[model samples]
Target: MGQKIIRFSDLTGTHVENDDDLVRIVVRQHPDLEDGPVEIEALGGELTAVEELALDLVTIELHRPGADEPETVVLEAEAFDRLASATPMAEVLRGAKKVACPIPSQTAVPAGAKERVNYASLEHAGRPHKGRTTDAEKQLVRQHLDRINERLAAEGVRTIDLGNAEHVVRYGLEALARERGVTLG
Candidate 1:
């Protein structure tokens, strides 16, 4: 006898008249509730509405059955618009932001954005011992540059191998760090 249900469209001070499953509730304007479902839960002698909404993300909140509250569920504008339009629920809610972009669009990761620099050749050659540089060491440096070029390919950027490509690696690292919005050690 404590259960209650309400449609998003019937949010206003409307009455269903004879539906026992339905609860009469005052509708509040919410950014998240602009175009979403409205569910009511009976607690003791009182009722509460659970609103599930999406903005950029999915969010849920509880509200007094009919009283307006300040808190709101905000979805990513893109997601909200898409959900509102695609679902029949959209016709139930009052307003919504324009469908600017599709929802669930994957965020693109720039090339070279990897936190670790994989210099397989240098790693295989092992760290230099003392100050004696051998031919193998020079080869290792070339290999490191090759790996860097491979990483740069995904970033859709150009790689410049200066007279000493090894030294230019610092510049490459800096550019990558800046593009990735991170600092390199």
Candidate 2:
């Protein structure tokens, strides 16, 4: 379970419930956020249901006061949302200052936006190759078999063994087998 980071700028009207321990004063000195130390005080400790979330700039840890717990509990995305309370999306956006715009790059995605193929990594990775396999696809796999095996191992998928007839047939790798002087079943 990966813990998602919550930045102060990404939230709106952050009033958490049962939040006697949420940090009241945060001095953010980041260049993009403000010019100097901005003392955000007197939030009155309430669990503001998270209206927005972003990562890797700054993080605010929400903890229940005096719970005899660890310093921080790393929670998954859904778990964080369930525990957090914030202003509604509309309320958060109402005349909010300083929306964090992503850098001008092909890989930059805005906050609250979904990235393609993340579902694959989060939901479908490590499973066997599924669906139909075209001849072109098989040839590509054959061309990059070594690199593919590396990626597969990184993703916790089993590497293809040339000696296994089932792997050759499943991946339509008979051409690769022939190149390796392997006799296919």
| Top-scoring candidate (lDDT) | 2
- Tens digits of per-residue lDDT for model 1, 77-150: 45655765666555635454553564465344457774422222444332313232333334344435456455
Query: In order, what lDDT does every prediction score?
Result: 0.42, 0.52
Show model 1 residue runs off by greater than 4 Å. 1-142, 164-185
Residues 1-185, candidate 2, lDDT per residue (tens digit)? 99955434213455444434445556544534323346553333332533354432323334455422223334454544444357553455474687466667856777899653321232332235534333334445665677767877887778777888877886667767888898855
Alpha-carbon runs more than 4 Å astray in model 2: 1-127
Clashes of each: 7, 12
TM-score (C-alpha, index-matched) for candidate 2: 0.30
Please give the distance, in angstroms, between residue 183's alpha carbon in candidate 2 and its true position after superposition: 3.0
Q: Please tell me which predicted candidate would have the highest TM-score against the true structure.
A: 2
Model 2 CA lDDT for position 101: 67
